[model samples]
Target chain A: MAQITFEDLSLSFRVRKGGKIGWKDFIVQGLRGKGQDDDWLTVNPLRNINLSITRGERVGILGNNGAGKSTMLKVLAGIYPPTVGKRTIEGTISSLFDLSLGFEYDATGWENIRYRGFLQGETPKSIEAKIDDIAEFTELGEFLDMPLRYYSAGMVVRLGFAIATSAMPEIFIVDEVLSAGDAAFQEKAKKRMNKMMDTASLVVLVSHDMSLLGEFCTRVLWMDKGRIKEDGPAKKVIAQYLEESRQQQAA
Target chain B: MTKAIAATSDYFTQIWQMRYFWLSLVIKDLRTRYRGSVIGMGWSLLHPIAMTAVFCLVYTTLFDVSLIEYAPFVLSGMTLWGFFMTVTHEASQTFLISQAYLRQNPAPLAIYPLRTTLCGSFHFLLAMLVLFVYTWVVQGFGNLTAFGYLLSSLVLLFVIGWSMACCCGILNVLFQDTQHLLQVFMQMMFYCSPVFYYPEMVEKRGMGWLVDINPFAACMELIRAPVLRSEAPEIQSVLFAGGFALVLLCTATCLLARYQRRLIFHL
Candidate 1:
């Protein structure tokens, strides 16, 4: 069974003044007898998160910008390890974030499909079996023969969405990838996401669309400044979240 | 101990499971490197071949050696040196180049270095084939038994290359100046090592100690003994290179284990 558990989880980043230090500064810092850690500013994106997500739950997260919603999803997706606590997860995880990021611009769309397939843990034979289906879903018939560099932004998203959602994931984690492409593609993408969510064992999604969350999620988590402010049924928590935001606007 | 072994094996298994992914990346690199070029991969060979020609012209006259022997010798040395330079230099950027994939998927970090090593090795192999044919034309085949040793040497060299790539890649990610530092260091190493001259020349110049301590000198001997002299590599040279490889492998493993989880922050 797919399960996720976070025990007292907290994550903090140590940011240097510059992104990196040069050798001259390193030697000077060493000779100055000042501790290296003193130069770093720590930013904590997650603090004291204790939660368990079991199988077969469609959970949605609602948070303002910088409220740690994406960070929580990344932690869940195993992209980041908790700094001071334990995170235990069972089952395969397929994360859909940065959907248009990792393509080889020189490679054709058909070849890119194979590349993405292999990255998602599909064998050659398996990808071959599903290649036709993914291609059909993209609706880019002759365009799939051209290199990715030649495709428009919308076409790239279409191809990315099709290949990413090709296989059913055991634990699917999505972050703000729904509102991609044109109006027609968004409608198709929603249908495809709904179909995948129906079969996926568990899914945790982060989105700004409260109506979308209300329609898809059974449970909702309202995050505020690195903490879960409220957790309840989707309707109740989203309603409360909207009410708070409205009050803040009025104030 | 058993737990350690299990973890090691599990790590390798994860790398193996992603073979298709990394292999595809390697293929893409090779394809794009020569795409739309008329000469194709010969472009990679041309640098060493041209360098060898120039060196042969200058060095044969200076040392009064025959062109036939010096040509293959310099070519072979240049080939191995080219491999070392390509792998370590390109591997330093492996993590940065694959940053997108790293953020998207949690695959083994070692595979990025492996991809760089494989690409470098492919070029090295092609260069070696040219060296073999040139040697055959000029001096016929070397000892078949000695040629067999080249196989083992290649394997050792591959491991060393991968380890160096891993170390350099991780270091470059953590320290932005690492690649520049490495370039300066490698330039000094090229001059110090017997890339264009014989190791015996260093000994004649009272630099015997340098030859004894230099791993690259030992590696040169390892390749030269089999191809030039038609003899097996001396056990001492093999042991020295092997010991260096072991040290580098351990260092790479330790670095990866310590930084694998935390590297994303640096990136």
Candidate 2:
């Protein structure tokens, strides 16, 4: 059983509190041994939350900016370790959170596909098998030979989306990457994502689009200020979340 | 204590599983360096060639040093020094530059340093081969036993470069001052270590302790002895190099294990 379990998982990051961060000042304070003078602010992005995600579950995370939604997804992706609890995961994980995750601007578009695919833990042979499909899907043609530095923002996103969706991942994670391309590619992207969602054992999605959540996920977690405010069926949790947002805006 | 042990073992296990990633990244790094350049792959040999010309002019011509003897001496040392410079230069920025990949997933922290070292070692091997062949044609090839010592010395230097990068790479990430500090340190080490000058020259000045104690001289003796001096490197120097390399690599591994997870926050 490929499952994700979190027991009282929490993560906090330390930040230099006094104004803007500068390496010059940090070195001076460090040399003087005045650690106290450099005020450190600890910010907990994930707090005392117990959650379990099992196989065949598509969980959508909804939250306002800085509400720990991305943090939760990142923790699930193994990008951040828990500060005060335990998290046990069983599965091969793939993240599509950043469009240019392992992209090198100096590398050609074809090269980036392999680079991104390798970063996702795909073997060279496996990625090579899908390179032709990925190339055709991106509609890049001769442009694939050019370095990514010359690629347009739309072209970069297309290349990223094409490569990310090329392989079947056991546990797929996405954050705002589906909105990468233009309207036409967006429709195609949604269709491809639906197929990936159907095939993947576990899909942990973080998105602000309520309609997308309702369409893709059966369960949704609404987070506020580092804690889950509501967790239920997608439609119901989203309804309550929108109502609260409306109330907060109106007041 | 057990927790630390567990983390260390898990760290190595994670890296072992991702061998392909580290290797491919190394290849990608090297390919990118000389990709569009005119000479292309030949660029790897250019560093040692150019340095040899300048050093040959200065030492043999200006200082009245013999061309036959000194040519091989300076060429070998400069090649090793080139490896040291390039590895440290690239290693300091390893973490900072890999921030994109690091943010995407829980990538192993050690891969970044390995990327620099592997890329550097590849270029070093190519550069050294060219230098060695050129030296052989000019002056006869040294004895076979000295070649074995040179091989071990090369291995020691490689480790020394890598371990320095590991410690400095993380420190560079945490405190930006480490990058600048490393540059100044490398410049000082270049003059302090016998890169352009002979170790015996320093020894004659009653500063034999400098060559004996310094790890760089020990590493240099491997390349210089059989290839240049045509003598086997002293066992004491070889032992000192092995011990120094062991200490450096251990410190680097321990530093990485302790702060591997916390590195993401710092990044």
Candidate 3:
């Protein structure tokens, strides 16, 4: 029973005016008093998000840049706690965002597989069991023996994707990682994702690729300014989203 | 009370469950730190040994202290101080160093500080071994029973180091100047502490209160009593060190609880 519920959730954080005040400025500000609000900007990345997601649903999120798609995904992944209201989740979650961010550049690909696998909650015995399968999927052959710093961007993405998707999680969350690799890798990645979607109890994805969403998602959520603008069948919602974007461009 | 206990136990369980992840990271840190160096891990030992040699020469020649007595004393003090310095300095950068992992996975925030402390402990233990062998060669191990107390003192120091790292790591993330501020503060502390000089020198100069209030001074006494004089650490020093460790652990826990989820945004 995989479920996710967000009830009137909102997240806001204060950003200092000059990128973090120094100790001296902090003291001066304390002494001056009262007008310190001028030195902070409150950013509301999410606001009053009310939604529920259940098992066996392949959902795609559609939004423009800074539309809170990634922020919502992060909240769903439990990376960010809401500032107001509540977020409740059940079942194990595996998120595949920022794929290229966490690799140890000094460690070789084989070592990275172990490191990333451990982070994904795989035990040593479990990782050893699946190591060969993950290695085969990446197709980097001799390159896996070399340190990650020497690998090209595309190669790193392949390794990251392969290791990340190895876990059989109850819920899968992804964010715009499919745009990086070459065409052949993309095709293979799609096949792998389709296979994962079949077994995964629920899947939530954020991508700008409407055609990809139309093909893979049963439902689509169109987000605008931290709120869900439209939620409907994949084809219908993506059509409305595309229609609005086309109208704006023509205007 | 039960709920709090359950939550605390749950937190520890989460940390225990992710042992492989953090442990592997600690090993990777240790490996990369010495990878290209010709002397490799010996570099950690050489730093304290070299400083001890220089201090021994100056003290024996100018201060008219006996080499046999002063060498082990200064060496042990330098080794302990080195551990304290390394742990706090590196801990301040722990969050930034693991920023990538923090963004990717939601492991317990304390593990990052633990990683830094474990690395520092490796060096500390290695240096302690050197001090042990040096003491045995010079004075033939004065009090065998006193050596048992070192075990408890090491545990206390480890707890203190971990807590300090946690607090410093979180503070550094919030205020980017924390590491710099800490460096200047530590410099002041080094002079205030009896790192190279005798603890009695401060007392003779009518400033025994400095030793009485200084937690580092208490720590020095804990290590020095057993290693230098072959006497068990006084109960007062032990209690002070233990009490200080508890206070810091509480502070670190509270800070982590408040900032664990929010710290990601700042990073």
Candidate 4:
């Protein structure tokens, strides 16, 4: 069985139209248009998309804003089912999408890590035994006893990263969290990810860093307008993508 | 059938994976709720006390009802009602508030709502302890045996709270106005249930059945009997309430699991 597959997946979100319709537009359309009035409303955030991911493969998804990178991650994580399509995911999975998703800011770092680690599928006994290791990795050390709200954004990212990745899963799904954090933490994160690559059966990462994509991923998936434009070796696909982007800029 | 099997396995796996997270959530929820300045968690007790005071004044002074005969009456109803209302409000919003967590881990969405309801009930245990102390000090612990009935009533309230929370939690995701709507519903229910007035106070013509259908009324009747030195609650009512709660919980769990992921888009 494949580790993950999204067949003709479609997920859309409806945002309530803000503000009253302008009177000027209403009157102008009424005068110029001949068709009946329409009350249908809402905008779709994600459209039909199809993709496949298999085991022992590191697939990297790249796309511009609103191009559906995050949406794809959510779908893969089962946070949002495809509005239309069949999805089959085999084995246990973990997500490192956003840092404050499960952590309670009002609680201490010790508490947040335990809660977050648990949410990520770590047992209490395991978490308790590894708290010191996680705490050391985060370098937040003594501050772990303090409320998370008191910590800076960098601190939050470090702790979140440590807790989430602490327990390796069969499949790990990470969003654009790498773009965050300071230089030192980023280096540490890369090193941690390198360690993960050694043990994880499959790792699906979404990042904007083409250079990093080349360094980590065996294959690259370039998404455009909710569809895969290229799915090939990291270096070749990223080079082609960059060339196309440059040409579009020039034009 | 395959989907169901897969889903069940995933649900159990999620439960195992997120057990620590849920336990931590419970602690965080309880700690944050009452961790502020003075009173601390004692305010958990204070809430029921203040509610009891309000009912005392409303029933005795305003309506000319007798508390001397009804002190236990108001205490039992309000305490149990407080537990029910608190759990309902908390559980109803559990998923909505934990959107961040839900968006990250697609495990059993039912766990979040259920965990919250359990947390709310835990606080109710504290408030129940206070009720025992208050009534004992005031009336001299007459029928300690009523503790059995009290225990059963609390369990009944837990069932109602858990079921209602699951229903409301799912509904609130679809409709943002559910919280406000529930507030109004609870207010109406407050007046409808025999919270302040005895069931006998109302003309017993056709409304007896109304009290039966109202789960809160059933809970109060059960609790009030033991506390007021009345007989044990009717076995039929207890069984009905317990059965009703179980059905609601199962239904809510199923719906939540089915719609768990879809909720992200709706939110």
RMSD of each: 1.6, 2.6, 1.5, 5.2
Clashing pairs in 3: none
lDDT string, candidate 4, A162-191, tens digits = 877787677778888777788899889878
Q: Give the per-residue lDDT of model 3 (tens digit) for A1-251.
A: 78999999999999987896666777788999889998889999899999998888889999999999999998998888899999999988878787656788989999999998998888999999999999999999999999999998778888988887888677888888876778799789778878876774788989998888998889999998988889889999999999999999999
lDDT on C-alpha atoms for all candidate structures? 0.88, 0.81, 0.88, 0.75
Q: Which stretches of candidate 1 lie over 4 Å from their true place?
A: none
- DockQ for candidate 3, C-alpha atoms: 0.71
lDDT of 2 by residue, A75-100 (tens): 98888889999999988777777665
Clashing pairs in 1: none
Off by over 4 Å in 2: A18-38, B1-13, B61-63
Give stretches of model 3 more than 4 Å off.
B141-144
Ranking of candidates on lDDT, top first: 3, 1, 2, 4
Q: How high is the lDDT of residue B36 in model 4?
A: 69
Worst 10 residues of 1 chain A by lDDT: A93-102
- Winner on TM-score between 3 and 4 is 3
Candidate 2 per-residue C-alpha lDDT over B92-159 given as tens digits, one digit per residue, 9 for 90 to 100: 89888888888886878888888888888888788777766866787667555467766777778878
**How high is each candidate's TM-score?**
0.97, 0.92, 0.97, 0.86
Each model's fnat? 0.62, 0.54, 0.62, 0.70
Candidate 3: which docking quality band? medium
